[model samples]
Target: MLYGLSYIFTKQATAVASPLALLGWRFLLAFVVMSGLIVVGVIHVSFKGKRLRPLLLVALFDPVLYFIGETFGISHTTASESGVFLACIPVAALLASAWLLHKYPTRLQVIGILITLIGVIVTVLAAGASASLSLIGYLFLLLAVVTYALYSVYVDKASAYTGIEITYIMLTAGAVVFVTMALIEALEHGNPQALFSLPVKHPSFAVAVAYQGIGSSVLALFLSNFAIAQIGVNKTASFIGISTVVSIIAGVLLLGEAFSSAQLIGAAVIICGVYTANNTFHRQKRQSQIEKKSD
Candidate 1:
């Protein structure tokens, strides 16, 4: 749900700060909070004896590539267009998980995934956005989807790592990459000092940064990794694109955006899809546990 809110606050942050600047501080703040948690013994991460390849790849795929693509893609495209693109994450994630982790979804789960995807397309297109973006924009969005999928699959593959550990490294990498990007952009504009001053000057950026850095980056990514570890990727990815629905609902409730009947129907379809997929998985899980206990 916080991912949905990230969309809303991202608009606010972008209004006050460049995308790279906003992402830099957003993740830098998250990294700071994560560091404090480690220092305070609130969270623990271990890197002893484990090869760094999987962890590094996971971080590279996620906060690094995913954000770069997503940030730029949304910038060049309309929000509704981006929503339709974001809707493809679960399907891509599912395929990646199946190929990489060998975690195939049940037929019923695939149907549910398709249902949710159709609902997202319906909801997004109901806004009547024309398909009119440059090829580069479309390619960026595609990169975002593919990188996000790879991230989900790698997180599941690296099941030895705890959620805290995965999220810690992801945020650390994000902070470094985005801060450097922000620095480069600032330099190109001949205003490097803006990186430090602009965020402090804008109250809107401050509020957006707090929520995005803490709630969305730190907590949400941790939960996502935990879910992927526990439930495997496809099941967790089933609800991946539901953020579009949540963003719409949030806009209606918080920002007083108009909510249409088609949107309401689309939201219901998404919920039904998620519930149907997870419900079947739980039932099968329980049945297997019962059989094991009987033996």
Candidate 2:
């Protein structure tokens, strides 16, 4: 739920700040906090040489690009719409898995993916008949989905490195790139006030940016790394399904956004679909293990 709230706050934060500025603070704060953890020896840090390339890839695809796409996309679209699009992530993972490994998706997996599509449609309907969403906005959200899908797959191969090391390296790498972009953006669009602004414009906005950087961007990565370490990558990825329901509830309660009946129905449908998809993977994993044992 902490991770889910991160998305909600991110949507609200971007309302008052540019997405790049938001990303800059988020990466910077998260990088600083994580660096502290390492320096204090609160978290043991280590990396595997063979896994360096893939970790870098996950960083680029997930943080550098995905965050940029999602933040800007939310600015352009409604939270409801963004939530619906984000829900497709798990389904995207399934499809990618099938494509790359020739893993035959179960009938239930296919059905779940289709049902989630229906949920997205219902959510969009709840946005209203006349809601003017731009295609550019939708494109950005889709870009997030695409980048994250690649990250999801690539992270599996990144297991040669510990999740802690991967998280630190990726965030640090993303921060370096984001900071450079932020510096250039600040220079090119030099409204000195905007460039040097702090907790003044909207302190809540600053809080939002900080929360995204430290909570969503940093802590989420930490938890994901821990989860993937304890459970395997595929198992940990199932938890991502929780983000859909979490986002809607948080959007409503925290952001004071109202959900239409259609959205409620969509949320319920998404829950059912997530259960089906998660179980499908679980069953397949168990079956594979059993087959290996038999051999």
Candidate 3:
């Protein structure tokens, strides 16, 4: 939920602050807080051999590259369109998993994915006729989706090697990347007129960045890692829909955004599809266990 709210606040901040600046500051704050945890004996780090290198890479892809891309992409697109498109990430992950595992989805699963896809398309088109965004921006958003899928898979794979610690390490690495990029951008563009000057034009924007840094980057990553540990990757991935629903509510209630009946219906269908996708796996796993016991 914190992760979902971060997007809303981030979009708000992006209105007043440069995307790179916002990202840099958020990660810088997260990095400092998390690193303090490491030093204070609240958290521990292990080298853990070469086995968990992929977790670091996934971090780089996700909170690092994906964040930067999505921030800029949202600048070019409407919030409604971006929200709907982002919700389709789980569908993409499911498709990617099917291809990589050579595990053809059951008929029911395919139907669910199709329903979700249709809902996403409906939401996108119903948002506005001028809903079109630049192709490059959309491509960046797609890249964000691709990395999100990879992040989902990798977090699940790396769960055995100390879940919370591993997550903190990966986030720390991502923070380092963001900080470096921010510093480079600062060097190129100059000192950004000082942090004190930030509140003069946009106090809300400053508050949003602080919330994103502490709540989303640090705390949400911790919760996600714990959730992935408790439930398997497929189950965790299904819950990505929760973030979509949260985003929709935030848009309607917090942002005073309105949607057409078509979009509402589509959202409902997509929610159903998400439920189906999750339950299908649960049923199949139970059936396999039952057969094994009978044998």
Q: Model 3: C-alpha RMSD to truth? A: 3.4
Which is superior by lDDT, 1 or 2? Answer: 1
- TM-score, model 3 to reference: 0.81
lDDT of 3 by residue, 74-139 (tens): 767766666666766767666665665344556666666667666666665677645655787787
Cα displacement (angstroms), candidate 3, residue 260, comes to 3.6
Residue-level lDDT tens digits of model 2 in 1-295: 6776777666666677666766777788889988998899998876634746878888888788887788778778876677667767766766666665455567776776667666665765676644337798899999988887777777766778777787888789778977777777777887646744744777877788678777777778877766645654444444565566677788888678888787788778867766765686678789999999999
Q: For model 1, which pairs clash?
A: none
For model 3, what is the alpha-carbon lDDT of residue 210? 82
Question: Candidate 1 lDDT, tens digit per residue, 1-295?
Answer: 9898787888888887899998999999999999998999988999998878899999999999999999899888887888899899989998998898787789888988888898888888776777656688888999999999999988877877888999999999999999899999999999998789976788888999999999999999999999989888888988875787889988888888898899888888888778877888789889999999999
Q: By the TM-score metric, which is better: model 1 or model 3?
A: 1
Whichever of 2 and 3 has more lDDT, that candidate is 2
Per-structure clash totals for the candidates: 0, 1, 0
Look at candidate 3 and tell me the lDDT of residue 88: 69
lDDT of each: 0.88, 0.73, 0.71
Question: After superposing candidate 1, which stretches have Cα over 4 Å from the reference?
Answer: 286-295
Q: Which ten residues in a row have the lowest lDDT in candidate 2?
A: 230-239
**How large is the C-alpha RMSD of every model relative to the true structure?**
1.5, 3.6, 3.4
Q: State model 3's lDDT.
A: 0.71
Name the regions of candidate 3 deviating beyond 4 angstroms.
48-52, 77-85, 101-107, 129-133, 195-202, 281-295
